[model samples]
Target: MKLLLTSAGVKNASIRTTLVDLLGKRIEECTALCVPTAAYAMSGGPGAAWRQISGRASTPMSDLGWKSLGVLELTALPSLDADLWVPLVQETDALLVGGGDALYLAHWMRESGLADLFPSLRDTVYLGVSGGSMAMAPQVGEEFVGWKPPAGGDAGLGVVDFAMFPHLDHPDLPENSMADAEQWAAALSVPGYALDDQTALTVVDGAVDVISEGNWRLFTP
Candidate 1:
């Protein structure tokens, strides 16, 4: 699987270039599925999902004009047959997942049977924004935990080995300052990254690279 994990969606030229490289095609040629399940657990969540699906959010996702775009609401997957949705996911060029509650997204991804399919999607791009990206980590850190899963803890899907701290130094989220990221990382058992809106981490074939047009930092524990 190819992962383009960003703090924000395609917010800058550098991140877009990395996305194109992962897709191996223009944005217009790819077919993407927008996963908005996580947003439902967020504040003003329905509105958040609508903005993401309608491409009206600050992020440049659904508005990128893919060949075709669809929504993959994870919450509703449990009631449907796998045959009904598995093929769609397998055929899509990318999964454009937006931000919200990390554990909530992780719970549904696991419960929806999507996380189980990750190993086979070698050619699929997983584009994650904020919570979307954090949900793939082994742990999101206690500070970011919101919608606690039944199993409990800040654990994620472990899709990637490291944890992530997004929106670093974001003016609107003063709590996400560098010092805050440091504190967050100090509690984790693995390495972690703090990325700004203009940065992203691309993972392909187990290799990871940072693609950024803004500041970022790596903290190792």
Candidate 2:
């Protein structure tokens, strides 16, 4: 599986280039599945989900011209049989995951059986923005915990061994400052990263690389 984890969705030219590189084809030639599951746990969730699905959000995701686009509502997957969605997921070119509550997304991914499919989706790209990106990390600090999961963890899935602090220094999120990120990383048991809106981390076949046009930092435990 390929991971392009971003603080914001393809927010700059560098990130866009990286995403295309991961796809190994033009965006218009690829099929994508948008995951709006995370948005529902946040404030103005329905509206947020609409914005993401309609490509009305500032992020450059759903609007990107794809050969086809479909919604993969993780919350509803469990109710349906795996035969209904599993085949579709394994065949998709990419997954565009929206941002909101990391733990919430992690919960559904596990409950919906999506997590189990990761090992099988070796050729697919997992494009994650904001909380969607954080959901891939081993943990998220207390500062980023909003919608708590049933298991009651202040974190996310163990998709990656490290943690991440996103939206660093964003004007709208004062709490996501570098200082806050430093403290958050200090408390974590694993290494972590503080990513600005322009930064991203790419992981393929266990090899990790950071690509950024703005700034980011990796802190060790």
Question: Which residue pairs in candidate 2 collide?
Answer: none
TM-score, one value per model: 0.99, 0.98
Candidate 1: misplaced stretches above 4 Å?
A: none
lDDT (Cα, 0-100) at 144 in candidate 1 = 94
Model 2, position 104: C-alpha lDDT score:
92
Off by over 4 Å in 2: none
Model 2 C-alpha lDDT versus the unseen true structure: 0.91
| Model 2 lDDT per residue over 164-201, tens place | 88889999988888999999999999999999999999
Predicted candidate 1 versus true structure: per-residue lDDT over 119-219, tens digit per residue: 99999999999999999999999999889889888999999999999999999999999999999999999999999998999999889999999999999
In TM-score terms, candidate 2 sits at 0.98
